[model samples]
Target: MGQKKKEIIKSFLLTLAAIFIMFIILFPVYYIFTVSIKPAATLATTKIELIPRNVTLDAYREVLFGFKGSKISKNFTGTIEGQAKIEDGKLYLTDGKITGAIKYGPFTGLKFEIPVSGIIFDVSTTENFQGTLKGEIEGLFVLTRMNDDGSIGFGIVREVELTSGDVNGVSVSGPMEKYVVIRNTGKAEFTAVGKFLNSVFFGYLKNSLLLATLTVLLSMIFVVPAAYAFSRMQFFSRDHILYFYLMFTQVAGGLGIAGLIALYGMIVKLGLYDKLPVLSFIYAAGSVPFNTWLLKGYIDSISPDFDEAALVDGASYLQIIRYVLLPMALPGIATVAIFAFIGGWTEFILASLLLTEKNQPLSVWIYLLMGGIGRGIDWSYFAAAALLFALPVFVMFMLAQNYIRSGLTVGGLKE
Candidate 1:
């Protein structure tokens, strides 16, 4: 009765721990999407709003289109006798006595006209009226003008210009130039974040897929034969060779392989450096010993009766392996494939050492973002990128969880 109570208590504690772990894992995912959807202005404010008070599409627009601002200056050269009218963000000449009125389009050529006594004046063909009436006024302008004939001008004015006016009232002169300012106004925070995420999400994803597939295929090729040899064939120093391979698993680390690779290069005289296929071979080589042992254990668990039965049916050793043992060891093969895939997928140290900048895996790419190009770390985009990087591995684990569990159980129990 006391043992039963202990077991029940242990199970309850395990359930509670699982729930806590799940919540901890999910918190960041919830936070990222929430921040992505947040408005720029609200993000700038101090108090955090769990639920957005004012949902806005401006953030998305800024990320896609970018923000633009312009500084426009209007220059005038004429005679003014009276005051100017300022209404609705536009300057209009009212009681001004001028010899002529000139209108200049924003970027077009200027137009000049003569006004006589508050009326339109048409002077004779070469008449130069030179009564020096001077005045000046300057201010910012927006595209808010809409004509009665259905023409639209500038939009809303974001900033007002500082103005200076002279006593001449007719002559206005200041630089009339517009300076447009473009800025990125998205929650992405930094451009590198997007690039890094892209590298890991798509770039790393492709490399990892290719590397994993090749690693698994090659590992199985070598592992199956070696396991079969160790299980059935008799050769000199076979036990010693198996012991050496088994001992290889306890080596210091990957750096030790550098010497062997160097020797191989001297003998072969081939440049395999920074190549993906070469890296895949290295990965397969490293994984082969453990995979061989794993397969050997699974094969040993299968009664030799199956192979003998196939042999009596006139099957050769290769045919027995192909037709009988291989099929029965599907679960174990899958387990080996998963191991090789994960190892290659997450293998960073060797990839970083061997691959060049362009050929580097996503893991190496992610590491590059720590402090390259003289730019500091951008956490927001980094977080987003990291989430994207982890997604595929997470998906793989979820998809293979059943097979992995069964394979592990079978291998453990049988061995």
Candidate 2:
């Protein structure tokens, strides 16, 4: 072949190789996604299917809502100011002020009016205690029966303002505080992503978000100044201190169970065990050394000429760093933040050991999903949880990817 033809062939081959590699890498992820949606009956079929023959979101539902029971009763907890008025034997709630307070359950936005038409089997309550009143919602049909009072029951009840974004066919579980039974017995089955999100798992998600963010903020606080000092200043035992940091990083990595237990004991003594900030600080402490090292390398590559210029302009060392070095080191700072966040986001073993049940991060739940591996286990749920757990990390990385790439590559530039 001629030169141009040969180059074209080479490019074509490289493109094909890249496509093949991408397929090999992503096929398993796609398969897992399919498996996660597969119905319970077809979860362990002998036949292999790239596209599941039957797909149901019960696993994801369980992950989000933590309620796999047939009943779909959810509790709404908050302060309310609305008056429920009875109109034509139908209860209608109007002008209600609801405060957001969810001690339990994933109902952060449980604001609504009980539409007049929603009141079925309308029986007037002498007590205005809507707190634990039970109501049945029959979206499909009306059930009419004679009560002890010899009155005909109003058969069908429906939400006039059905959730603009309601789960297409959420299951009706056991009775709620107010007998608001959602009878979805004859409805079309659909994904319960909404149900899952409005669950306790969402609390775990919130906890992880808080921890990871605090870890990043705390890591920046600890790493930036130290890295700048190490990069720009020459103080007493500076070299020794840098070496000590390097040693600490290595030692922290190699710390075994004994070290963990000792740390646990110290946490107990300090009475900081199971606290979110304590775990965040621990993550930041571990992150600082590596992040400092990374930032130091980036800072070193930027000449001290900027510091000299700032000094000539009557700026102090701190001012020079704040104005000049910090702006220049934005990418490096982002890289460090990414590292700290990933450390906290994915740290399961340490979190489980140090945190309480309610305070534990999503990492604990992620690990629990895989605990049943190698047994009569459902791998689909594990896959789903793993994917969801890694989603935030993926998003964080995407947000900071350019910075990380540029931060690491700056050191490789020619003078």
Candidate 3:
């Protein structure tokens, strides 16, 4: 065989292998996307489906917005069965029962009954009196000035809780509020209100975004100056300090459950538990030593002649770092920022250990979904949520792909 023909065959074989490896790597992502689009009911089938069947965005919908059945009832009428008394210029109602009919659009005439205690209203001779509901449906209510016939106008200004009870044949729950109006003879009307987004999912997304953003900012703030100092300045024990940072990188890998336990105890003692900003700081701290070293190397790869030139021009050290080094080290900085973001965005163990439900990030929530392993796992919803969770990191990598490549490679060439 000719040498060129052999080379062509070798090239073909390498291309085939590359395609195969690419397929192997990307199949799981493709499968996850398919699972996200597939209907929940279809995910339970025994057959392996390479192609999704019965595609529906219901999972994504549920992940972004809560259940589709959530509704707000506009018309509710009830009677107040307790007497109102004035104390300290405030009107109070105790041991009251509000029994009424609520109409939630298509779901009409639902029985609305709630026990009320210590409901308070501010006394006002003109305009309206503002009151607060403290029962199952808690909110502020406003009563307009009495008309000439002695009837009062009323409406709810704000409600804080979702009503949990059976409304006619339907179960009412999850992120719904109520608006109420009180009329003559203790008759009150309520309008049910609903929030659109799924609080849990959005909360997790928000926490992740916040944590990632803070990690990047804090990491940059802490890492860049230290890295620049290490790269540029020489003082006593400078090498020793750099070695210690390198040593910490290795030691950190060995810190397992014991370190986490210690961290948990310390966080609880310091009253910093469940705080996302604190978590961000922790994430930034964890990335610092390695990132400082990495960035230092990238900075080192840039000739020190730039620093000398800037100095010759009467530029201060800070000015040299700002004007001379940073612009050139952007790739390294981006690389560090990306690392910090990924660390904060994807950290499950520390987040789970330190954060309560309300403060937990998406990673913690996704890990908790594994609790449904033995039980019926909602693969569709899980897939959708997981995909959404991974998107920010994926986007960061794609956006900074070139910088990351250069940052990781060029750093090693110099140091």
Tell me, by lDDT, which candidate is best: 3
Query: For residue 406, what is the lDDT in candidate 2?
Result: 83
Ranking by TM-score: 3, 2, 1
lDDT of 2 by residue, 226-315 (tens): 988998898999878887988987886787887899989999999998899998988898888878888888888898898899999999
Give Cα-based local distance difference scores for all models.
Answer: 0.56, 0.64, 0.70
Tell me how many residue pairs clash in candidate 2: 16
TM-score of each: 0.55, 0.67, 0.71
Query: Model 3: how far is 7 from its true place, Å?
Result: 0.8
Number of clashes found in candidate 1 = 15
Model 2 misplaced regions, further than 4 Å: 2-13, 41-48, 55-58, 65-108, 111-198, 236-240, 371-378
RMSD of 2: 11.0
lDDT of 1 by residue, 283-384 (tens): 898899888888777767777888878989999988987889789887778888888987887888778877777677667766775653223444334444
Better of 1 and 3 by lDDT: 3
What is the alpha-carbon lDDT of model 1 when measured against the actual structure?
Answer: 0.56
lDDT per residue, candidate 3, 1-415, as tens digits? Answer: 6999999999999999999999999998988888888776333562457976888998877777552222232444444445444445444565665655554456433344444556554433222223332223333334332233433333333343334423222222222223344544343322322222323576678888899899999999989999999988989999799889879867976888888888889999999987889988888888899899999989989999999999999999889888988899999998998998899899888888888987889999988876876438888888888999898889889989999999999998943
